[model samples]
Target: MSPISILTFVASLLFADLVNADRVLGAYIFQRHGDRSAKAWPPTKLTSLGYSQEYRTGSFFHDRYISDNSSYQIDGISTDIVNLAQVTASAPQDDVIDNSGEGFLQGLYPPVGSIATETLRNGSTIQSPLNGYQLIPMSDVRSGSGSEDNTWLQSASSCSKAKFSSNNYFNSKSYHDLLSTTRGLYQSLEPLVNQTFSPSELSYKNAYTIWDLLHVALIHNSTASFPSSVTLTDTVMQELFVLGNEHEFNLAYNISDPIRAVAGMNLAGEVLTALNETITSGGKSKLNIQFGAYASFLSYFGLSGLSSANANFTGIPGYASSMAWELVTNDEGTGMPPHVGH
Candidate 1:
């Protein structure tokens, strides 16, 4: 394996070795939504490529975890029954996440042969409808709905305490220390950002939106050139992208205070709750929970754990990238708690 991939594998093993599970039993997946238009702009919708990307991700999961010959497959549960009672799917209420979940589930339990043949009381064989496509229940968890917490999926925006903690990081010596090398890059980009958004709307404290605009424009609209004369060369834009990503990282999880990871803590708690429910209920009530959020949150989640294992764990996750924390056990039902791995 490449160095980075090897590091990630070693990290997973370390996490899995803790508490010593007999084998993997269940899992929880937190994924960054697939390709979409810039959120800073309007009509932020998923692209056709986004749908295809997530579909492939789901298919990959099927081969690894749900296939009949896979070690992770639930005993006595056929792949055809995955959509019936063996799997439950979900995402955030945002349309981007919702669509991504839909595409992913379709791949996990594709339409070709989703239904099972059954004999009725009158001895008549009944074939399922919808062209053998089973409809899996997908619950979009709305923030602030009853007891649902916003920190779970919207941690970058919703965690009040984490926000407070992150603010302190900006004032820390480490931030200033890094700024010495980055200040020049920011200076060049500041004028462009100011021109794009009102002074009140954008600032050094939160210029991620500006960086995002530049990024999207470079990727999606570069052939036509930018509407404004705020020219940014490819090298400059790439540097700014890295800096902006770092800003987002520190905002989500600062090293000085563990409270900076409060958002991740909240989401991790929810993941564990879902996994434990799946295990405690003998997989009867377990959910195939799928969380969709931005790459910033995914980096933060990793910084809270994986960074300790791999210092180079700093790249912003790719579009539709996912992390799964599998719950493994053995014949004796002895296992460790779920840990972030594949």
Candidate 2:
């Protein structure tokens, strides 16, 4: 072959490589919060058990992405000896358990009984207190004649006197403080509150708060009834997708919202199916399937809703969790076991 012909062939090979690179499938996945104990009145943090669960979840991903030799290869070397890099972001808003500032333990337990009341008929002192702090006539309690010596009357009079005479407590200042705190809390939720978008934006920030709230409630609420005011504001819907690729690609795509979820799942499924089909048609070696998902999401499917008819509508054999399963046969037309790595 001439020099120019050889150079042209080398350039053609590089072009083919570029085209194949662009065709490779990528995936991203987001998961719900990790298992938590019942919310504490003061807002419970993750417990030791919860931390252990998280650690195991992280390890599972690491093994799947970093240690899988047949499935995940990094820099032309097996990832079996390296750990996958993981990053986490947290919710900015504080989880408030009890915002009603009565007392810490007051509402934790239910009230035993109801308070008794008095009825006034002819404006006479009815149901007067026998000793103290009993049901007393409003007139006697407010009267300045000092004939009423009950503890309730004494307490009320003391409170009235203190309000009038003291400079320590100002009602206006207290009201202002309450308003300021409320405004601050509202400001903290500005991201969710201030989302203004056209009909075309496909970003997660546009749909996350609403989707997350609905999804969480749907899975956790006992009633399992849809919220009355649910309106699908956007075209995006949440889905889970499986992908077989390097850990970096998965991290880069990082599914964060319903739109991304559905898109990633569809794209990954299509690409994987196509790749498997190509191997079968061309008589190539079957590629191993190495997949990773958001840790909490795996738990949800394997242990929670995805296993039930109430949660899943269309069920098929070999389909597990939100992932679609398929087998690729070799030239001998022999079925091969799926090599799932992580």
Candidate 3:
């Protein structure tokens, strides 16, 4: 068996440990923030549904990779009272994503309801808050040249080469063809977004923004008042989603230059380096979870040749989506699993 294995979830795919003979070492997880308030509206926050989505994702992973009964459990990971040294998590300080991380951790290490109290050395006893909720520190990944946060989304990082390559797409004959052909489709959306968008903003250029506004309404405000007035038909909404997917994927990657998807390049580098550390340290560092947006997922898929794997890999990932890498080996006694694997 190969020393390295991957478990990925796109959209609503369920979590299941693959049946294999390889021994589990450790894993690295990259997760997208769960559902949140629409970005079209400012000050976006994680909603109840978003929180639940993240919590459920974390719980499923814990069951498969951390629970005692799971055959794939990491060799020496802490199931409770999290050993901060073995597990590490990081997320940008954005409110929605930051809050999403906490929701995931809640399920990863649930409250110790009965073991909440501890006697102090001074004959005083104190109980942890929220019934001994495990408090794990998720480091803040700030925006900068070398920081990991910037690679999670194109907008978070400023890469001149990437910007130039991306802009060239807008000038292509294909882009122009689509823009002219899609006018009618966009115009129909005026009634729904009339107040929020100008006539010019309804074009293909703003496909994602327009789609997101309506999508959130379809999920949360179907009965309530949304931007202008007209309710979107299911067919129209589906088209918008398709258009948005194409638009976003194009911006994140292209055959012209790898610079177009620098975010993916950076992520690949980080994943490789971290995995190497796990092997070198003999699996002392167990699990690493990082949370980010969908942009990185799109680019990573393209760069890693996963875009050809399935329909899901080629499109925008749904909320709470995740991809993981496991360091595995069939060898019982090992200094390091083979440097290369079958």
Candidate 4:
């Protein structure tokens, strides 16, 4: 999809049904960064379209929680007025991830009115140059060995156990089965892969890279840079894409080791933390919290049973897509908590 269209797709598919519960005390949003150039390319950053997409996501939240008549508004906050002190956002210390949060915050709390128009005692007028643009803060969580908060936000690479499982999965019986099943299709795609990357050999192990290239080209490139020989139909591309996605899901989360669940839990742990804090504080916790993470984590989260009760957690969330979790008290008056992931 083009950058513009992906924004609309994300809005309808991801954030449309986030607030269908009773007394949505607060919400936590985990979003994948918006579209960008292929990682293989140097200086991979958010494109103009990506900025627009992320900004739209931020704006969507602003309207839902910051606008007048918002059902999910935070306490001690006014409509059409944002309390920057009450908001919290975090992402791994990567430019793309950082910029994603920044763009979203800009749209969520854009400056609407002048800061000040003051006249000094000496008849000198001092005016602020903010130009009605509000500057909100976003936290940068450390990845790797630096901090624990980013373990899930950067899970795919940070989790050593998941990494070990990934390597083993590549050589497991299941991997062999998948390879045999898609052998024919892989053969057909061999030339395309080679033409694109010209790697030493295009095997099942590295097929996802080829798919990534094709996926990026399909969305970002037109007939200009895309090769004429690379003539895979939409059906063919979809099959390959699904195959790769399934492979990634299995590799990232479904290994035989129990540690495979670490990536999912690390991120979900934050959600649970927020929920618990909110519940403990009499539901007066921060209403909106956003964290950016990789897409593979989304898949792992889907299979982690956190969203199993949720029907909308059927597939992987798309680019700039987000999953919201609502914490609500049960109607039984027994004081049991029901944490709903949507």
Which candidate gets the maximum lDDT versus the true structure?
3
For candidate 4, write residues 1-342 as lDDT tens digits: 111122111111122243343334556777677777665453557767778888998888777666666755543444444555456677766666677778887777776654445678999976545655666676655342221122222243566765676567778897888777776777776555555454344546555555666777788777556457767788877776666556655554652464655656666677777766665655456555555544435444555653355433333355677666654332322222343231
Alpha carbon lDDT at 113, candidate 3: 69
Q: What's the C-alpha lDDT at position 134 in model 1?
A: 59
User: Candidate 1, which segments miss by more than 4 Å at Cα?
Assistant: 1-23, 69-71, 113-130, 142-158, 173-195, 198-204, 227-234, 285-287, 295-303, 330-342
What C-alpha lDDT, on a 0 to 100 scale, does residue 333 get in candidate 1?
Answer: 42
- lDDT (tens digit, per residue) of candidate 2 on 191-262: 432343232322221222233333333344543243334432222223211111111122112222222123
Question: TM-score of each candidate?
Answer: 0.73, 0.22, 0.87, 0.76
Model 3 misplaced regions, further than 4 Å: 1-19, 142-153, 224-231, 333-342
- Candidate 4 accuracy as lDDT: 0.57
Error of 2 at 96 (Å): 12
Candidate 4's C-alpha runs over 4 A off are: 1-22, 115-130, 142-156, 190-196, 280-284, 299-303, 306-315, 328-342
* Residue 21, model 3: Cα distance from true site in angstroms: 2.7
Which prediction has more favorable TM-score, 1 or 2? 1
The TM-score obtained by model 2 is 0.22
Q: Superposing every Cα of model 3 onto the true structure, what RMSD results?
A: 5.8
| Strongest candidate by TM-score | 3
| Candidate achieving higher TM-score, 1 or 3 | 3
For candidate 1, which ten residues in a row score worst on lDDT? 1-10
lDDT, candidate 3, equals 0.74
